[model samples]
Target: MNAKQIIVTKNSEEKEFYSEDKLRASLRSCGATNNQIDVIISQINAHIYNGITTNDIYKKAFSILKKFDRTFASRYSLKRALFELGPTGYPFERLISALLKEKGFKTKVGVVLQGHCVTHEVDVLAEKDGIAYAIECKFHSDSRATSNVKVPLYINSRFLDVQKHWNGNSNNGTHLKQGWLVTNTRFTKDAVDYGKCIGLTLLSWDYPKGNGIKTNIDSYGLYPVTALTTLTKKEKQQLITRDVILLKELYYNIQVLQNLNISANRIRQTKNEMGKLLHYDTFTNGTR
Candidate 1:
């Protein structure tokens, strides 16, 4: 099969060719070693077929990755796994809250606060070291969709209102308050421009390039519970609905899987996978 044959993407768009360089880059981005990356690329090249979907290619590569390193496979599957958190994004919000907590910030999900003029339910509120942040987490199931300018415009307005009322409240210990717009997808160029011009912190999948959401997730090893390949969709959904959002959380509380009626063998598999996924040394070199 020719690599230059058309391939379908997740969004159903057609690309004329598949580039080995691009695949290698993606593998490297997910912390695959040079030797492992080369092996994966060679395998992918050997299996290339006309009309192959990118999704299929990803699955093929992931299966190969799992054989070599389950941890790297989990990291590589982060984006797709994130999409599994949704239909409602409640799980994503919880995951974001957990990630912030890992960073030494006190976090709250689905917090409803009264602004100067109206009530706003912030997706995630993070407070640390006398600074409080009202974060709006926008999750997208579609890979092609972007968090656009209007979202920040609306969020900034709400944040302004909240800041006005909460400015002098000493009880909250908020010496400084800011608004952050976080998304699971990329940000539009206009959105980035607006955020930069107005000081709204926009953390999208790849908007800030080197220091985006994927970068943060990789840097802190904050893999979501959805990233566990051993767990079934129903099992993952049960965990997420019960607020078991982080892989680290599952690692420490292995009994939670028992509560969900997962089998002893599956529970053990989950633990081993989490061990690899959250191992600090595995992610140390990948941080930006």
Candidate 2:
């Protein structure tokens, strides 16, 4: 029987009997169909590890998948494995947040909300100096190196929306100041360029020595820390304050000029009336 079918039927004791089935079983557990497993088995010269533990079974499946096409090794596949691990939930958010904390940054997990059409709670909301930032986590499949698209653009749009909603102004001060797209895979050159042009920060993550997410700043194709500061919430607020003050001063100057112009026109009208009164008196008396 295939691993998926077996998984539904067998208990712990029964599962032990199938442990030594090797390639066929491991491939099935990794979501490969019988036909797919047949092709992979045909290519193998030999198989090692006569006795496989539960953990070894997972490793073996991942190892076999590395030999397959990359399209099958997407973020979708990694999430499926996380689901199969059990019901309590994979610590995907906590895993990334801990790494950020180690870097002397505070991280809040699952705070930002998207929309009803799309359900996404951001992995981390990092903050420093009263400014918040976003980090989206993607756990890549063991078989493939990391890669992605769309996240950068989505972040830009959502950021603007969040700013408009919470700040009571067009400026996005209450939301994340800057955006960080975090993933287990490395980013492509075009993605990095797009991020640089529009002020998005990309954080590439790797498995740490002990396990869980760790920062790879050197490998990460992020904009420099200097470039990202302007995108922060605090900086945006400062710019808003300066603009407000300048506008207020301009309005006050305009009001002063308007009042002065009105007073001068009134004085000219009063003088014209006085001249008309003097000319009427002389004409009525028949004097030069």
Candidate 3:
């Protein structure tokens, strides 16, 4: 059965909902392994109940995955569920926009680029210090590094895409400068290099621990992936503390954007500098 046809929906609260059984059937038909199915089911059971709609089911599922759990939560599966949950991509868009705004960057959503009259949905269009940045939030599993080549490629191509928007009839160019790839998983070497070659920056986190502790480090604080690795009892507790601090900081930053008034040109400049800072090489790695 195709993925679409597999899901059975009912209208509830004036919205469509999908049954757990239907979700499982669709995942299975999509070639999900038994283990993946179990992990998904466990997430469902954790929050499953009567009156749960399809969107509710996925929201719960992705929530369970926000932490980087080594067992059961496949990043690939979580990513699939996320995109599948929204045709225009809601939670994902809001999450990215919220993250950027916290950094004091001004933002715009769903920018329209001319040519083919194609409307490309951007998660967050950020501006700071006379520069603009396009942030694409890709929440995919590690497996998608191979299964979904387009994820990285799209990140690589965003520069040209954005440039076209600037150069298009509108001439909104101003300080339009760079792009960012924000993902829950690490990028492949090629993807990283590609970003560097074209001056885009890729930011990803190590898997979080079962308790939802992020590990890797970046401007965003503890990488969400680190939240879920094996650690001594004390270490685990420490990890949670770190995640809390990071989250608090994130919240504080986003709050700052609510009152700020900035132009798109400044945001463009900020994004360009961010791209360079993220890609600057370490002497040992022989990259710069």
In candidate 3, what residue range of length 10 has the lowest lDDT sum? 207-216
lDDT of 1 at 43: 83
Among these predictions, the greatest lDDT belongs to: 1
Stretches of candidate 3 above 4 Å error? 1-89, 115-118, 141-150, 167-173, 207-288
**Count of backbone clashes, every candidate in sequence:** 0, 1, 35
lDDT of 2 at 94: 49
Q: Candidate 3, residues 1-288: lDDT per residue as tens digits?
A: 323333323322443334557667655643457776778777666655545555566555545443433222332233332333232343445546655675788887666543233456666788898787777776543223421345667654655665665655355645667877776545666776666677776665442232111222334432221122222234323423433222233232332222233344543332232223233332333133
Model 1 alpha-carbon drift over 4 Å, by segment: 1-16, 168-172, 280-288
In the predicted model 1, the residue pairs found to clash are none
RMSD of every prediction: 3.8, 30.6, 16.2
Model 2 CA RMSD to the hidden true structure, in angstroms:
30.6
Candidate 2 local Cα displacement, residue 113, angstroms: 4.0
lDDT of 1 by residue, 85-169 (tens): 8888888888778778878999989999878898889899899998889999999888877878999999999999888878856
Candidate lDDT scores, in order, read: 0.82, 0.44, 0.48
Global fold similarity of model 3 (TM-score)? 0.40
* Cα lDDT, model 3, residue 148: 36
TM-scores vs. true structure, each candidate:
0.88, 0.38, 0.40
Whole-structure CA lDDT of model 2:
0.44
Q: At residue 265, what lDDT does model 2 achieve? A: 58
Question: 2 or 3, which is superior by TM-score?
Answer: 3
